[model samples]
Target: MIEMINIGLPDAIAYRIEGKITEKEMKTVLAIFRKKIKKNEKLIIYQEVVSIGGVEFNAMIEKWKFFLAFGLSHFSRIAVVTHKKWIHKLVDLEGKLFKSIEMRGFSKEEKDQAIEFLS
Candidate 1:
């Protein structure tokens, strides 16, 4: 499941992910992102992924493609909070593939720092 917390800022979109992420959840997130992109020239995304166990591999692959299609044109910054070290390494290594977006991964303890960076 994904829960969105609107920070009431034009430049920020915060989301907390738990349990399983379905196609519906991905659609909702993408919809909100599209709207935010239209309204703001640049957006900062703060995503906290608590667990990846509940997510299906196929669903994740589909979501990955969706994000790849979306690209980095709309967002300026992306802060990801995850406990998985492999995820952090992946983000660090592949983040350069995105042109405009600056992606950063953080541990749970660095959540505050991530938020601060995005803000």
Candidate 2:
């Protein structure tokens, strides 16, 4: 599941994620990104990932569509707050794939730092 977190900034996109992500959920997220892009909103995403098992098969397709539509490079910065080491490493590794966006992983205890970093 994904939910928007309001950090008192229109362009600052913060979301909380839990359990398995479904295709329907991804579709909604993709739509949100599209709308933001249309409005010329430069985005910075802060994701709180917890107990992420896996995304549904159809969700992968939606993800690919998003990657194609936006190249996953629309965001200028991305901060991931998580307790999972693997999740942190995965995001950091994926950051290399997109040069336009800066990706950083912050421990759960360092959420304030993450917000500061993104700002």
Candidate 3:
């Protein structure tokens, strides 16, 4: 399941993710991103990952399509808070690949730090 988080920012949004992510949920998130883009909002994302069972294949396709269509310029920063060390490492690698967006991973304990980084 995916739950939106309110971090009190107009251009920025946050979400908590747990369990498997479905195609329906992915579409919902894409809709939100499209709305932000249409509004000309420079976006920042903060994701708190409690647990991830997996992502549906269709959801992955949808995510890739969104990125391809919109590109990454609309995003300014992405902060991922998770307990998994592997996820942090992956985020680090992703940061290297996606140079335009500042992506950082924080442990659950450092969620405040993630928000601060976003700010």
Candidate 4:
């Protein structure tokens, strides 16, 4: 499941993700991104991963397709807050792949710092 979090930022959106991610939920997220992109607003994303069960195969594919087609350029920053050590390492590595977007990982305890980084 994924739930939107209102952080009171016009150019930023946040989500709390848990459990398995389905294609339907992935579409919902992509819809929001499409809207933001249409407005010509580069985005800052704050994702608080409470718990990840697994991603549906379709959902993973959909996410990759969307990002490949339209998302990469529209993102300015990404802050991932999670307690998982592997997630932190993965985020750090992926951050290097995108020169235009600044990606950072924060411990769950440093959620405030994550928001500050987005700001």
Give each model a TM-score.
0.79, 0.90, 0.94, 0.93
Q: State the lDDT of candidate 3 residue by residue for 1-119, as single tens digits.
A: 89888976556788899999999999998899999899998789999899999999999999999999999899999999999999999999999998998999999999889988988
Name model 1 segments beyond 4 Å from true.
6-10, 54-70
Candidate 4 residue-wise lDDT, 13-119, digit = tens: 89999999889999899889888888898888999998998999999898999878885888999999999989999999999988788999999899889989999
Per-residue lDDT for 12 in model 4? 82
Q: How would the candidate models be sorted by lDDT, starting from the highest?
A: 3, 4, 2, 1
Arrange candidates, best TM-score first: 3, 4, 2, 1
Top of the candidates by lDDT: 3
lDDT (Cα atoms) of all candidates against the true structure? 0.80, 0.84, 0.92, 0.90
- Global local distance difference test of model 4: 0.90
lDDT of 1 by residue, 9-52 (tens): 55777898888887777778777777877776677898888876
Residue-wise C-alpha lDDT for candidate 2, range 28-82, written one tens digit per residue: 8878888888888777888888878788999999989788877755688899999
Worst 10 residues of 3 by lDDT: 5-14
